[model samples]
Target chain A: MIRLERKFASLKENSKKALVAYLVAGDPDISTTLELMHQFVLSGVDIIELGVPFTDPIAEGPIIQAAHDRALQANTSLDMIFSLVEEFRSKDSETPVILMGYINTFLANSKALESIHERGTDAVLIVDVPGESSLEDIGIQNKNIASISLISPTTDNDRIQKICMSSSGFIYYVTLRGVTGASNLNEDEIQKNILNIRNSTNLPVLAGFGIKTASDARALSQISDGVVIGSVLVEMIQELSEKKDYKKIYNYLNEISAAINP
Target chain B: MDNLRDLPNSDGFFGNYGGKFVPETLMFALKELEDTYDQLKSDPDFLKQIDQDLCHFVGRPSPLYFADRLTKHYDGPNIWLKREDLNHTGAHKINNTVGQILLAKAMGKKRIIAETGAGQHGVATATVAARLGLECHIYMGAADVQRQSLNVYRIKLLGAEVHAVDSGTATLKDALNEAMRDWVTNIDDTYYIIGSVTGPHPYPMIVRDFNSIVGRELRDQSIEHFNAFPEAIIACVGGGSNAMGIFYPFVSDPEVQLIGVEAAGSGIETGKHAAPLNDGHPGILHGAKSYLMQDENGQVIDTHSVSAGLDYPGVGPEHSNLKDSGRAIYLAVNDKEALDAFHMVTRLEGIMPALETAHAFAALDHLSGKFNKKDNIVINVSGRGDKDINTVATMDGISLD
Candidate 1:
């Protein structure tokens, strides 16, 4: 089992909800992103989803798109992102690191999968590539990293079964119909889908998309194993970049962590 | 060539390209579309209905006119213009939109969504939605909305809601992303009418099928006019729908040559052009694996063109496959060449061709010495140029009052 599987197993054993925090690598700059990864662990984040910035992130909302532009302006390539993960792994070997981005970013670089495995990337979530596609087709099946799959309310039961069967690490259930940072969250609908997904597979299901407040995370935690806070953290990072205030980011994540764990 | 009909295999792949590379939220919707299209494509009743619409509504069998002046000027092959420009809504875009709107009606989808670059697709889609009495929404890049104001107005005048998208590069690709987001959110009630043959599995096939009438008509018309098949067929490649429409029927005809013209903004060497087939590598973009203009890190690069329709970083997957298979010849026509052809056609034949279609005309100059005088070459005049008059005027420094 990989670090993600081990982390989820440990979280389930302790009856604790996993706190997954997401930050775009090189959002303000690469150095700040490195500092924030360690800060994420300090604030009790169990799994860190480091976004490898691409030119077009269709699934994201305005805030994340702007963050992607900032990261691209800083020239954050896949190599630099892998180096960041290697540096983070040196300090904290236990925390699961998930690199999330579009498929082209991964497929463009010939050595991307090898570099990912070499740098200790525990999981990868390509937002555009659906569950119907296998890791083998994407040229990452035999690698050490787990290919994370996304499930949404619109996904039918038959496809859900297929997606669950192919997925590794965990199933990320998108809570809303819209893009990331969309405000509308139907908790009852999400609960029903999560139940169906849980019945299909034993893999831990994590709820993401539009989880803004601690209460939102707390409520989402009721339906799944964990909650991934992306747009909210990205928004905070954008706001904090002007001041270069890492403390605010730590405190914000601590609040979310406490809410999910409590 | 015999396997042309069995393409895209069972899993929506066109030989290592084209698949469902969308978020899971839209998977069921894509499957539904695929299933519905599979059933309806061969259904005699559905085919009959679409045929009637094409004949009476879209004005099918748009005349194939011989461009005498253009042919004489080139001192080469007898150039024939397949007049898709004469279709309703002033472009070949209606061919696919009309077919898809019928599918949407058959699927009982009450809402329709589309993305546009030059607004031709948006206008065509909106016109069909108005006729069918369905709610229509069009996503256009903010930059495109400003540049193509006439088309934007036409879409709005047709009663469709036009959303100005201001994300990414603020162009066709970004507008496509917004439309996908909208479709994912409203998958239950909405049917997305993708303008080009560039999306996931069933879309490329479906759009090509709808637009293939251009080639079917040309085949019959060519036999009637020339007593033989044209030596070569040419069309402009913007997401490659019009080209694919005209190219599909001829794929099996080994004796006939197929050529696709791409926009070379200033020049391919300048790195500003949108000629993906010439300069791009194979990669996945906009739900299909195709030739895309992207950086080493896989980020889509900003593309430029005189025609908004061709200003995208990627080409259709089938075009990519055709290029790889060496079945089709792809060439780039820079803005100057296309503009010169735009004027030449207007002055020579009294046909003001769409900027996109002008690229096909411009290729004649490049093929000046390659063809025999008796060899017939047919070019798809994909649209009329009225929507582009303002742009042409602006470029010529002639202020449009």
Candidate 2:
């Protein structure tokens, strides 16, 4: 079986919904961001989405934009993000790490996407190129990490099928019509949407975008394979940056993870 | 992290503002600027050269003046003006254009190209190209050419070619599309002197820092005039380069109100305005997401402002942050009011402002009569009326009647 399929089966056998959390690499401070990642996995985060901030992140809102700013200031590069993954591996090797960001950042670093994926990232979600078939069609094919794509309300059945065929790990189904971090919800609509995607592929359909609370995640997991939470985790980091100890950020996520499982 | 304007650790931010959040396309350009500018600032060699050039070439210190009659006309409070208009190229734009042109020359770039809306920046580019003996090309919307014919003539006389852009709305936005296209096409051999603090990364940061001259001069002048800083500083926001330039120095001074006037060509309620902070939704535009006017379907919508310079749908991301944080309050002024301010300032102060500056003039009523009184307001008279003489004359139903 494929590695992504294995990951899904393992989580299914354990009766645990995979918890995926994202943070822009090198935000606030580089060392602290890495340190916080180890803390997050320790607090039961199953997968990490380490975002590489691009100069132009059209899909993101202001909160993520500021995170991009802090990361760039610390001179975070594609190579640095890989080294960060390796550094995190030294402490913990079980949890999966995904490099999430724009394609331009990798294109600029002289490192091809496939080569960088070989450094140990388990998956990638190129926000702008969602469900687009460029990864396989392009000269550089990443064999190690599954290329994840997002399906939104705007995505049609034909495109959804294509995304599912191209997807390896899971199809990220964006819940809202707009960009990430929006607070609007329509469970009936979302349940129907995820069902449409699930009908097309046996691959797990993970829901993302504005999943802030355990109730939201738990509600989503009922219909979907799992839930991917990002902005809420990022906002939690920003709020606690004032408190000075970033290690405590994982504590916030710990509560959310327990409530979802409970 | 702490708001520090001073440098042992100014690093990249300006009092909790200014930092790089850009892609790698601009990293070379931004790093080049940071290193070279730090050297040029204190290099006694470059300073003496630019200072002498400013006096004999671009005009020095611009001027600090009191627009007393214009102040009295408002019927509320005293208004002091920083006469950036009197500068040789006719506005604060020359300050940035000159600095960039010099940097381009030092960096060995032989060709200079720019994008403009009202032709204010085009004239500045043409002026610098003439002084530096470099090849110059400027792209302006075809509509701006019809409106500001004399500026078109002036640029031609300076021997620069003006490419009439016909894309998008066939105005400022189109001109920017053409300019960016030109830069990307010729990145190896050309220097793209972006006109405002709007564009991708380094630009918003670079342009604001260069225009910081206006803020520095005003801070000293305000202390000289009112024995302290003014209660408020108002500037029209197109891309917000001028406002950021002046506002950067005062961002941390909690007592002073930093007012940014955006072009509400029609009232904000009319759905025809370019007030990014007031109405724009968050989405990717140009290269970054600050605020952008988008359709209900989430597609970016084209905007209209009688003033060509203020005719954009989105604003710089930095300005977006300021609006969100409450560090600055933005207000909008419509076309009729701006036209009225154009004629009013021309008649009262004998100064004709660029249509973009007229947006600042339109906010006087919003400032004096309606808002708090006993507040000293310093308006950056960003440009001269010379370019807008025909615009004002046509609106008055007389070409000197």
Best TM-score among the predictions, by candidate number: 1
TM-score of chain A of each: 0.97, 0.93
Query: Which candidate number maximizes DockQ?
Result: 1
Candidate-wise lDDT, in order: 0.90, 0.74
Model 2, DockQ value?
0.02
Q: Write the per-residue lDDT of candidate 2 for residues A177-252, one digit (tens) a residue.
A: 4445767767998999999998888887888887888889888878787778888777778777767676556776
The weakest ten consecutive residues by lDDT in model 2 chain B span: B1-10
Candidate 2 whole-model C-alpha lDDT, 0 to 1: 0.74
Give per-residue lDDT, candidate 1, residue B332. Answer: 95
What is the C-alpha lDDT profile of model 1 across B39-94, one tens digit per residue? 99899999999999999999997999999998888888999999999999999999
lDDT by residue (tens digit), candidate 2, B125-145: 999999889999999988888
- Each candidate's DockQ score against the native complex? 0.81, 0.02
Can you write out model 1's per-residue Cα lDDT over A1-262, one digit (the tens) per residue? 2788789889989999988999999999999998998888999899999998988777888889899999999999988988888988889899999999999998876566765776878888898888856767786644677889999988888988998988899999999988889998999999999999999999999999999999999999988999999998999899989999878878888998889888
